[model samples]
Target: MILFFGTRPGKPETKKLFHSICPYCQQQGALTAFTVKNYFHIFWIKLFKISSHTTIECSHCKRGFYDNEFTEEMKNELSK
Candidate 1:
């Protein structure tokens, strides 16, 4: 899934604001690692797609959010 902000270009401030409100930004622990898996009829393979992923740690709440549903939703909205 891919999530994108619906804002005009050349507006860094707006982009920053949008990111701040993003669900992924609300997560903590910083995505230390990411894994991807592919299943086939005979076998399955699990590999590390990215060693490190962009992450945001909450300073006050100390919470973690690694949900990708937000991005999927954004993609769906854009398709419509």
Candidate 2:
């Protein structure tokens, strides 16, 4: 029998935060936050989620940032 167990990244889910500012773009740009998760899979089927990260993107500039870049206040406001 062949055993198949490994970790893989799941599909990213994004939510837009309205009326946001982009420091890089220096404009009133729409901010979108997304979640990416790594999951344990067996036989190509995801068994369980191992780790997850939330990140933000600028709609106008199309830049991405790590979770640490944004404050908890920003996350709390935009994550919902």
Candidate 3:
């Protein structure tokens, strides 16, 4: 019999971290806390969480910012 195992993306969770200006959309109160979690899968079902990350989102223009795009101040803001 053949076995199936691989990686899968879990349902992302988002929280209202705070309101801030979005650089992309240049809009007010467009910033939010976004999270992505990846997991190992077995038979196409997620088994366990393998990795996770947090990011910033702009609701106005519907843009996202990854870890690499975060500045030092941005990092600090998330920590709080």
Candidate 4:
């Protein structure tokens, strides 16, 4: 039996972080949040969502920040 089950990532939803500053570029309002959902797929068909990940990126410096690297302001804004 051939099993074609795997996980795939969904389209990332992005939102600009207002009043958020990027630590790498030191630029204000340059932070953007990206939320991506992973789903389990079988035979190229999506079955169920596995998990989701949130990442922050700096448009000025193009630096990526993970969950543990998020700043206080970033967390506050993302929560809303």
What lDDT score belongs to each candidate, Candidate 1 first?
0.30, 0.79, 0.76, 0.93
Worst 10 residues of 4 by lDDT: 17-26
Residue 30 in candidate 1 has what lDDT? 27
| Candidates sorted on TM-score, descending | 4, 2, 3, 1
Question: Local error of candidate 2 at 16, Å?
Answer: 0.5
Residues 1-80 of candidate 4 have per-residue lDDT tens digits of 99899999989999999798898888999899999999999998999999999999888899999999998989999999
Better of 1 and 2 by TM-score: 2
Give one digit per residue, the lDDT tens place, for model 2 in 13-72.
877776567666855646788888999999999999999988888888888778778855
Work out the TM-score per prediction. Answer: 0.22, 0.78, 0.63, 0.80
Top candidate by lDDT = 4
What shift in Å separates residue 30 of candidate 2 from its native position after superposition? 1.1
Stretch of 10 with least lDDT, candidate 3: 14-23
Off by over 4 Å in 4: 1-4
lDDT tens string, model 3, 1-80?
98999887788887664545566777766678777899998889888999998889877788888889865645666777
- For candidate 1, give the lDDT of residue 34: 23
In Å, residue 33's CA in model 1 sits off its true spot by 13
